[model samples]
Target: MQIYTVGGAVRDRLLGLSVKDRDHVVVGSTPEAMVALGYRPVGKDFPVFLHPESHEEYALARTERKTAKGYKGFVIHADPEVTLEQDLARRDLTINAIAEAENGQLIDPYHGLADIEARVFRHVSPAFSEDPVRILRVARFAARFTDFTLADETLTLMRQMVEEGEVDALVPERVWQELARGLMEAKPSRMFEVLRACGALQRILPELDQLFGVPQTAKYHPEVDTGLHIMLVIDYAAAQGFSLPIRFAALTHDLGKGTTPKDVLPRHIGHEERSVKLLQQVVKRMRVPNDCKDLGLVVARFHGKVHQVCEMRAATVLTFLQETDALRQPQRFKDFLSACEADARGRTGFEQQELPYFQLLLDILKLVQSVDAGAIAQAQTDPSRIKDAVFAARVHTMEQHYQFPLSQSVTGGSG
Candidate 1:
């Protein structure tokens, strides 16, 4: 049997990127023969084996035939007769269809290297439309390779797939998995752009889709379009090396603006609460993680105050931290601040400045958290009064230590 390194390892190496993992395809090998040679069979639908020493995967040369609908509706045929060309031809993108021989010789029957050089994301064959997951995969590739452009024909095929209801058949888990991965990529906005261009985003994430034509107050958001502002926010978060939860918060922080009343054009009075409500629906529908869902909801609810934190009184600041559960989740609280900074800088001319109040707000959270709440609790006679005493004490400490902007003030220390 001849083993050849294939897929991402080959593609990444060709792009001069550090290869993360190596996948191999074993040609002219049977499952029984592989088992006899110390390779353990592990594949569920096709013949895939693990190396005896390295434990790396070595899938046999296989061909897939579309049997039904969705990503899993595939019939796999693996045998000694299957050629490497056949296996490579079934892949989605041209750059991912290249393989490398054991002797370091390249086996490129699909001109993947040329496509890589051209920074083009071209499909290997029409089979790409057979798997609905390819739509997500292409979007993910657009996010990862920020410089690459999708081939017009490939985009046309994707649009046709969406029109044919292929994207609708994608399972929720797979959709979320791909979307989350895309969000963490270098330029995540490209993923949404590709999805929107293909008409799949409106089908899958209608809340986010509705943001495109929505307007925002130009004085606050020079970008003017709420959707464009959020995309800029996501890119800024990515540029800042923020975590996935932070990026997700940037993406969903303004969902309510999409539903603003026509009479309130360019003004979103209670969009914060509306954003939180929409965030809850998305969290349930996407099966988002508790941490991501919780953070997105909090950021959506309080991002306006977070942007204008300099105007908040000590009690309002304390309430903001408390509502976000910052005392218990200090790290996520930091992430929340980072995402808010992304929002502040996402505007057209504001990109040059460090977010207006990062260090200032950070000092407040740190100081309030440093307060001895247990002592305040012990000083209280009534148990129910303890919580209120501690909060008052924290607020008092903030009031004494920091100076807040008086241009505007938020009343009621509850969000």
Candidate 2:
């Protein structure tokens, strides 16, 4: 059996990128032979093994046939007769099809090297359409390799796959997986843009797709288009090297604007409430993780309030903190603040502007966290008044910091 390093490791190495992990394709190898040689069987759908020494994955060179719908509907054939070229031919993109031999000889049967040099994303074959996940993969690759443009033919094929209903076959988990990865890329807007171009965005995320032509208040969002604003927000999140939750929050924070009445025009009055309602649908439909879903929902419902923090009274700010559970989940609260900062900086010509409220919120959360809610609870004479007393003390702490009037009632609302 001959083993060759393949896929992203080889492609990244050739492109002068740092290779994180290496995968190998074993040609002319059978499952029995691989086991005899000390490889541990791990693959459920086909013949894949883990090397005894390196623990790296070594999949037997195989060919696949589409037997049903979706990504998992494939019949695999792995045997001693399967060739390396056949395996490479089935890859999603040409650049990822190239392999490196044991002796360091580069295999370029698919002209992957040429495509890499030209910075193009070309599909390996028409078989690329068999797996609907390839569309998400291609879009994700666009986000990763920001400079690489999709080949005209490849884009056309992707569009065809969407039109044929292949994109709709994708499972919710896989959709969320690819989308989460794409959001973490350097220029995540490209992923959405590619999806939009192929009409897959409308199929998978119509709530977001509808935002493209929807206008926002140009005075606040110079970008004007709600869709463009979201793109800018996510890219800014990525630029800040923020976590996936923050990026996801940035992506969905403005969904309410897409549903705004045309009669209202640019004013998205009460869009935050609308955004929270729409976000719940997305979170449930995509089966989004709790961490991401929680953060997205918080941002969708309160990002506007976060942006208005500087002008808010101490009581309002205190209410915001309590409502977001900042005292209990400080890290999530920090993430929430970061996402709000991304939204503030996403506007056209506002990319480099400093957001004073970001630090203000953090500082306020920190100050309120110093309030000993546990101790106050222990001192409360009555059980029913415990919650109210703790809240009043916390509000008092905030009011002291901001120097609000001492005469303001404990239940006084922000005026």
Candidate 3:
């Protein structure tokens, strides 16, 4: 059987990027022949095998046909007769449909190398419209290769897919899967931008989509569009190399701004709490993981207070940490702070502003958490009073370090 490296391995190699995993397409092999040759069969729908030595994935040349609705409705055809060119034609992007022979010869059946050199994200064939997931895939690839521009034809097909309601048939898990991957990319805003351009964002993430036209206080947010601010925050999280939870928190932190009443104009008085409520709706609908959901919830509800904490009394600072369960989950508390910092730096002309609140808040939290709450809990004679005693200790400890005037402390609180 003749085998050739295909898909991402070839695409990334051509792009001069580090290829993490290699997938091979065996043009002349069957499930039984592959197994007999020492490869292990793992395919459920089509012939896929694990290499006996490297353990990398190797799939027989295959083609898929649309059967019904959504991504799951597909018929796969894989056999020894299928050509590598035919298999490559079925790929989503032109940049990914290229293949490489074992002799290091590049195969450009669909001009993937040319598109890669041109930094264009183009579909391999007209059949790109057959799969709705390709829209999300293209958006994610945009985020991955931040310098690449999407082909106009590809975008037109995506918009048509959305118009045909093909995007609506996507299941929540697959949507979340793509979204989470996109959020962690080097530049996440492009993912949202592409989705919005295709009209999929309005259907998939309306909470964020509504923020595009929403105005914000120009004095505070020079990038006065609430949607743009959120995108910037998410990009900042990515730039900081923060984890998925932190990035997720940044994305959903300002959902309330989208829902603010028109009469309120640019000022979002209770947007923090409003953001938390909207975030809940998104997490539930998207079935986001609990770790991400929990932090997003905390950041949504308390980000404003956290931003302004340096101005508030130490007692209130202690109460804020207690309310967020920061004392119990220090790591998550740290993530919450990181998300807030991303927000603070995401605005226009504010990225390099020497904001002292971040450092001050960290120092305050350290001092408050240093109090021997365990010892204080042990000293309490009444079991029910243990929580009260620990709370009192943290508040008392915070009072020692944060004795500044509330008005002075509130400086640089707006994010």
Candidate 4:
């Protein structure tokens, strides 16, 4: 049997990046031979084994053909004669099709090393159209590799695939896996642009695509359109190296604007609430972790709250915090501030006079940091006094800084 390192391990090693996991493909090896050699059979649908000593996965050389629809519709043929080149031809991207022999020789029939040096991403073969998931992978690669551009032929192939209704073959889980990886990249905004250009975003997230060219009242938004604003926010968020959930929060923070009335001055009076609902639906569909979904919802809901708290009383602020769980953890509050700041900074057209209001909100959130619900809940002091003091301080700070009419800001009569 001839064993060779394949896929990401070989690609990453060539890129001078540290390889985390290594996958081996065994050519001319039968399942029975593997079993006899003490390898443990672990794969269900295909002939794969775990190395007895290293515990790494080793799959027998196999060829596949599309037998039905979607990624799982492939019919795999595992035999002892499948050549290494034959196996490489079925990979999604050229860069991932290269292989490293046991003696450290690189095999690149697709000229993957040339593409890598030129910062280009190309499909391994026309067969890339078979599995629609490859489109998402291409977008993810674009997001991760800042300098890479898709070749014209590859772009044409992707467009043709989209036109042929291949996107419908994708499952939500696979879509989210690629999307999550893109969001976690160093420059996630690139992912959106690539997806948009490739027609993937329109199929998977039409709501997001609707943001393109939508006018925001120039007085508040100097940026050209909502889509550009969203991209800027995502870029800024990624530059800060925020967590995946927070980055998602920044990416989707303004999603509600697409559904709001275009004629209105702000055109987004209750968009935060709408965005929360939209995020819930999306997160549920994508099967995201519950904690991440909750975090995303909270960030989207309160993204605009800071700007409206000018005249709020301490009691009102405390009550709001209690209800929203914003102060449930230090990290959550920090994420809230980051989301708000990214939203504020992403817009280009607001009058310079409005900067103070944004600064005021930031200052107030920072000033009340020690007395937030999380702290109050952990403190051993008297509950009633602690709540009363925090509430009063919040109100007094708002009045001193913003001159906001407390009576109008708070729901109940201000004490």
Name the best candidate (by lDDT).
Answer: 2
Q: Which 10 residues in a row give candidate 1 its minimum summed lDDT? A: 406-415
Off by over 4 Å in 3: 377-387, 406-408
lDDT per residue as tens, model 2, 315-404: 777888879889889999999989887888888888877665567678778888899998999998898999889888888888777654
Tens digit of lDDT per residue, candidate 3, span 1-415?
Answer: 8999988998887788899999999998888889899999888988899999999999999999999779988899998888989999999999989888999998888998889889999999998998999999999988999999999999999999999999999999999999999999999999999999999999999999999978888888998999999888999899999999999999999999988999997888899888989999999999999999999999998888776665566677777877888877878988998998888888887886565666666676778778887788788889899988887778777666557543344445554
lDDT of 1 by residue, 144-219 (tens): 9999999999999999999999988998889999999998999999999999999999998999999998988877
CA displacement after TM-score superposition, residue 81 of candidate 4 (Å): 0.7
lDDT of 4 by residue, 1-415 (tens): 9999999999888888899999999999899999999999999889989999999999999989998778888999999999999999999989999999999999999999999898899999988989988988888888888889999999899888888888878899898889989988878888888889888798988778888887776655767588988887777778878787777778777777778786773456788787878877788777887656777788788766665564665556655665566554656766766766667666653212233444444455666554455565456377668766656656665556544433333121100
Global lDDT of each model? 0.88, 0.89, 0.88, 0.78
TM-score of every model?
Answer: 0.95, 0.95, 0.96, 0.84
Which portions of model 1 miss their true places by more than 4 Å? 354-356, 404-415
Model 1: pairs clashing at backbone N, Cα or C within 3 Å: none
- Cα distance off (Å), candidate 2, residue 327: 1.8
State candidate 3's TM-score.
0.96
Each prediction's RMSD over C-alphas, in Å, is 2.8, 3.7, 1.7, 5.6
- Displacement of residue 81 (Cα, Å) in model 3 is 1.7
